[model samples]
Target: MSSELLPPNWPAMSIAEANAALAAPGSPVQVEDTVIDGVPSKGYTNAPPNIHSILFLAAMTHPERDYIVYKDERVTYKAMLRAVEHFAATLRDKYGITKGDRVAVIMRNYPQWPVAFYAALSLGAIATPMNSWWTGEELEYGLSFAGVKAAVVDPQIFERIHEHLGDLPDLKHVIIAREPGDEHNHPSVSSMEDAIGPANSWADLADIGMPDVEIGPDDDATIMYTSGTTGKPKGALATHRAVIANMFNSLTCTARMYLRKGEAVPEPDPNVTRATLMSIPFFHATGSFAILIPTALRGDKIVTMYKWDASEALPIIERERITSIGGVPAIAWQVLEHPDRDKYDLSSIEVVSYGGAPSAPELVSTIKRRLPNAAPGNGWGMTETCATVTLNIGEDYVNRPTSAGAPPSAVELKICDPDGKEMPAGEVGELWCKSPSNCKLYWNRPDATAETFRNGWVVTGDLARLDEEGFLFLVDRAKDMLIRGGENIYSIEVESALYDHPAVMDAAVVGIPHKVLGEEVGAVVQLKPGMSVTEDELRAHVANQLAAFKVPVEIHFMDQPLPRNANGKILKKELREQFTPRG
Candidate 1:
């Protein structure tokens, strides 16, 4: 099925051939054999050794370039470096923070978010970014779980977790950025403005020089928490090498794309300012590893928003000349379908890519039709993989819209059955990935670490199949699959069919308990604004594409967008509860 989608000369050369030239010895993204945590693995030989080193190099290469843009504020690379240096100094001298200590960063997508993150990392402290959407109790649980010594938060987050501070004995210091008018005063709390001043004034601060701390490539760098859908969230601890490997892997993918098109990779053009709309939360792996760090290292501009709004984003894309804009399919869809989108000059966009959820196949054609200048892209990854294991972009994505593309030279992917045996091509099984970008382990959870990370491979819970050409087609999450009358049903298939309907905007398929059948297929759909469809019409839509047993036995409609977690994944457990019987 996949082979017919590509031409005989398409990609110009094989993926293996392209990698040989791109990752050859002495090349920028050279690959080398290495050992990580006693497990054999492959890594990027020429990548930056640590996050601090990358920050320093970025500052040196683009001192006057705009690094961050939020509302009316713009921070240059030089100014951002000064702020990170001063903040790191304060963390070291005032708070006695050092290598291996955990410092929590809990805030929205504010410019200070990156400042706080880099500050902690620069001082060799483990930067733990907790979800800003977590409630006070959830936030407290994360702080206590990581044994955080200090936290940098915004006013809203500070208010949310203030009362719970007494429960966190390890939390010794708290720094609030952009605090509102004289609020509740705590003995351990301090103002970020007082420490680093406003973003615009950072250039005037005295440079204390980069922190004189020794950091190794394999040292612990970040502890990102997974979404706690089934139970308590677990921290996925990653090393400096793991995070930096993702940067190189991203670069390698782009280089491969150009080579596949029979074109030489373009050199870095300092005159052309590359920019992206920062829509996703920085805590998520897709936002931090895939978007933030990569763009920062390239000296590109990041335009942030307090929250994502299509109406507000349309102008930002035009005003900032955003070259890339995507976090998830829903985000890209909103911008593409916006009523006033045609009113703005969005011709600056070149790529519209998304991941972390199932996207409709029609979305690819729609993007090509709506924004003729942009190429639609998709991929598959997880928090444990530190984002981006396989990516499908440009012509490859347009041809195989449902496939998750292919992995790069530094990464290995295999499909395994329940008994841990590798599955043959075209057979559905759990997708497992091995790469230097994979997280080291789950913090404080040995059982989970042992179960998920096997010999450097992260056993992703998603069920998928690879084609002859190595294109991945996700079936469904292992736990989310429904069995009806002994027949297996993958929800994504039904949801995709529902999305084909012109009126359907978002859809999720859940299993409803039955007396005789054991379980029945059920669907919940959100229609496009001002568009309507009958339940019978939607059922017929899916029935046409799938077997009768796969059709939803019942359907429910919602006026609001589907409920999603911070990672932009649909909360199926919540949707399932609606079908439960009550006394």
Candidate 2:
């Protein structure tokens, strides 16, 4: 959509003009040409040299401010820094963890997670955050794959990986957070309380100070594993620069939002506290790079949850005055449609954003209708890109509901055909992105790295198109697109149509085997509570928006939300099994 068609006072300046002003020299988010891993790319000139620098700045700037809020516990930046320093000292002095050693952080979204992560990075050790939801065998594979020397895990994760610890001989130390009184007689296992004390008492611990280690911008800082749906998960090795680039890109996006509104960007106001409800797990890039690091740098409070529950989140928002709420679309949907949402004082919310899945356009309008103070935001990113490649929010999202917002000046986006040839705008093809935030390589998988990372661009498997204004419209994953009798069908289109139905809460479209056609369109839908819809009614609703062939031949009603992976993407493979023929 063009700016001329946008709502009045929305996008007062063109996207190009906003980007030009933001990237000009002397700007806080100035963009510059640079080389990354032998390939030319654009990078932020003012971004922190590394993640530890951001942590140091945060601690020095906001010592007594609340940094992390879990259930009944609140940790200040001073306490967090103390814990990080003490843990770093323990890792170095006790376990002999040094630069270049891989230290795995396998835990849920707790205060200890960030402590473990920052401590390892501060010591120049590669911080590998494994999925806490993974099974014992999967955890074993991740630990061995990275050759981790030490691991910090929650009590539940400890039990999950306890049986596999003997299998991973390279793992020399294990620290369990909030361990129960039961004694597990393991040689390598230890308690986190012994290292840094409890979460609240961290500030009183003897602070040995940050580890004296040299960490360069291009040095490997993280090894984040991808959500393995098709095959074994590949670990994307990211540099310190790659992860920190996200912080600047987010700042640029925020500046652009102000410039596009014909308003000057405001300076930071320390008196007004900004808080975000962290519903997503820190294991994902969207959680770690996008939310965790950025919020810390700005001294924003992060109210975390053990898991996402709208009932639990609403009261926290009311209590903490959360300024932002985000995760997957399902998270925002539950909050907006919650039966008791009106019972709370949720006037502080300003942004309700989500990504990592296809969202219904209706969700945008719903947010506008229900929460007048909040603006609905969406973006497109992947594990390979770190996060925040393109952000669509506020009026821009309302104007082009389907298109993901354009990239910042520091990133390049393109559409390519199957043969790696660039495609023209409005053409459906694989979306490729090039930026300083792109991961260096897939750990221990040279062939996979060669296939995915072409030059500096990460060949994202998502099938998308660029509009004339550079807005991205995602069609579907390249592998998820189905062919029925030689006609291509994008599953997202059908899923979007299903979501258009008022009663539908979550929906997934998958291909079911057919004797005649190569594959038939099939759908699994979960309706909102107290809502009812027949399979025929849903088919008719979709038929009104899509072709007959695209309509689902079989529709399965689910009592619960559609199954998703750790990254909040719908598990179409598991849903496909529902259509399996009974022998």
Candidate 1 overall lDDT versus native:
0.88
User: Between which residue pairs do clashes occur in model 2?
Assistant: none
Model 1 Cα lDDT, one tens digit per residue, 17-119: 8888887897788898999889988989887878877777888899898888999989988888999999898888888899999999999988888889999
Model 1, position 140, has a per-residue lDDT of 96
lDDT, residue 56, candidate 2: 77
| Model 2 agreement with the true structure over 1-583: per-residue lDDT tens digits | 3455356767698998999999999999999998899987898888887897787788889988899999888899989999999989989999999998999998889999999999999999999999988999999999999999999999899889989988999999998888841377788988888888889898787656788888888999999999998899999999999998977877887788888878899999988789999988899999999999999889889999998889999999999999999788888889888899999998999999998888898888888778889988999888998888888876678788887798899988999998999999999999999988899899999999999998999999999999987889999998999899899999999999999999988889999987778899999998887889999999999999999999998999998778998789888899999996421
Clashing pairs in model 1, backbone N/Cα/C closer than 3 A: none
Stretches of candidate 1 exceeding 4 Å from the true structure: 1-8, 180-183, 580-583
Write down the TM-score of every candidate: 0.97, 0.97
Minimum summed lDDT over a 10-residue window in model 1 is located at 1-10
